[model samples]
Target: MKTDADAAPLPMLYRLYTAGAQIASPILDRMARKKLQRAGVSKARLHERAGVASQERPLGKLLWIHAVSVGETLSILDVIKELRQQAPRMTVLLTTTTTTSAELASKRLPEGCIHQFAPLDTPAATKRFLDHWQPDLVTFVESEIWPHQIASVHDAEIPLALINARLSEKSLMSWGKRADLARALFGRFSLVLCQTDPVRDGLRAFVQEPWKVVTSGDLKKSSDPLPVNDLQKARLAQAIAERPFWLASSTHAGEEEAMSAAHKHFVAQHADGLMILLPRHPERGPEIADMLRTEGWRVAMRSKDEAIAPDTQIYLADTLGETGLFYSLSTLVFIGGSFVPVGGHNPYEPAHMGCAILHGPLYANFAQAYADMAEQEASMEVADAAALGQALCALWGDDEVALLQANAKFYIEASRNIRKDVAGHLLALIAP
Candidate 1:
């Protein structure tokens, strides 16, 4: 619940933000349309960015969820499923801002859910969206703060919540400078189910009541294992029969070079071992493949359908939506973005598939999750390419890999109820 404080006038900074958004709406709408077109969104769908619905909102109690992009969208899938099971009469509208996420939603969202491109953060666009959907409850996943959107929801007297709410230190410092605006924007949320205690504590500073920010567990932990294409997995398994291999997934710029050096060490030990390089951005496939070739590694680019020949040292899996297939095939996995300054990709993804997880020192974004996994001996952190190679070489044995996989799976099994609890909280927020 919203209190008198939440109902107060918007702060000066928030007013300025809303005013600026209103003034820039037209230009922003045009830019969003152009981006959608470039992303291959049809002319009919382009209007979605302007809060024009592509399909009629389903009748009955509708719960609307807004996720910023792919990661956030994936994180909430289980929650939506849980909500559907518990509230069979309710229809869920899942809105995301990226075309890739929309495509994923088309394939993955549960039966009761509807997917849409989120409106541009402008007064008119948000107003149109809310007026059309008239969601009974609204949720914003993970730091998607738009002043116009929040104010419009509050003005509509809707109960809004922030689930899996995470706040980075950088974001805190930035918002901390404008306490009034922060309060105005954040206080409107009826509840905040935080992923971490630090984020909950930090957000309490901006909310009307400290009790509103509860430290609920990360919903991603409860997400189902990444989807796999059985046909593709089987084909790859046949092609890679009886060969030692490990994956270096979601890698970044400098991390690829490090992994290449590690692969050199790997091949020196097991001549037939394959190193699968899955970059965070797949468009860099050609560049990474070229770099590997220059370094004397025979690279097979997945996008080009290059076969993993007997002599192929690095199989660059640069295509999208195949992470699950690779993880299913490899027991030893190095989750990248940690070797570089990037705060690391999700270790849970690999862990859920029972892949023994490895990473570098820099994973502050997932510090708590990593710490928990480390305590259970579910994950290992390597300092550099040499250490990564050594760790992989050591973990190649069946017993070593099995232990890590068991511990990681145990961690996942223990957290199975987090999303259920979150779903309960969200359901409670629905209007009576």
Candidate 2:
């Protein structure tokens, strides 16, 4: 790490960015709260984001990790657990941006670890949070780069790493436009493990030192399948026994309508067919259920305490954090949030569960996971509703479930060592 004012000045654009954030920090707080309110952030917890401590930092060496949201958080819990067991004296401070991520982190973070809402990216807030926590090592999950936060850590000479870093086409163009800014921002990290070749290549092109970038295994591939209660899985299995079923997991606004169209066509061929539709936001359960009901489908919502009757065509697994249970009951799980414009959700959930997976063409969020799946024929990508319907019919027509399931399992196994390898590097960096 650079010392004695050797770090480059924030590039022109980033300097302006930080200045703007600092200048508007007060107004920004109110606007942020409004945004958080719309997203269901807890009112009591709003102080944390303003760089106020809700809980005292534990005594001893601390590792502060930033996982931007639920999908990014999911990939790191297993690693965090392993790190906790490996270093008993070290405490983990996990920070997330969204309410849903905070909720999941509270349950899954290892014992003694603290979960806090990440501070907004203003100079003062970043400094206050850094000074209070005094983390021994800092890690950012995925590509959640905050200019002020990175600057604070770098200036302090903290050991920093970025895991599962990725770059979409839009992200690539944005970074590529300012080489000096990109390199200055990225160079602060002691290590960067990219999830895909394109991301690795993009970083190399953006930065002067290409050595920091590597095409590495995605953390999601190593995550445990979404947790499922055994009793719950068994009950669901019995309820949907001997029925040809497909699932549309983690769907978005536009994609559900498309999947419903496909389901209507699919049910015509298989009378007892059922489709499990789990929207990306479970709060929209009523809206989604009502939308399908008006289309002449018998829909049962999980949140509403509706059970799947014999004639129920769609079982809406509309609750949070039980996706794994439904995965066990599904023969064909269409990884959703892709059929629409919103970049797709994590594909690793279905892959980790050994479910036969399908998705739309827009699944850029988990590009590496999907790429690996495609390489091994573990999943299929459909073009649109009509194409998705045809693909569903094809899966129904053939006895390829065994083959698809095996391939999905194989893809996950291929990357099982990623977490250990990443943890090894992290431990060495912050070794006592």
Could you say which candidate leads in TM-score?
1
Each model's lDDT comes to 0.89, 0.83
- Model 2: number of backbone collisions: 0
Least accurate stretch of 10 residues (summed lDDT) in model 2? Answer: 1-10
TM-score of each: 0.96, 0.93
lDDT string for model 2 (1-432, tens) is 332244345788998998899999999777767877787767776767877767888899899999988878888998898788888789999999888898898777878799988999998778779989988889998888888888888889887888888778798899878767887888777778888888888777755567767766788878877778999888888888888889988898877899899997788888898998988889999998888999889999899888989999999988977888888777788888787777777777777778888889887787767777888899888988888888887887487877888898888878788888877777777857
lDDT of 1 by residue, 169-287 (tens): 88888989988888888888888899999898888888768898899888888889988999999989988889999999999998899999898788888999999999999999999
Top-lDDT candidate index: 1
Error of 2 at 416 (Å): 0.9
- Candidate 2 has which clashing residue pairs, if any? none
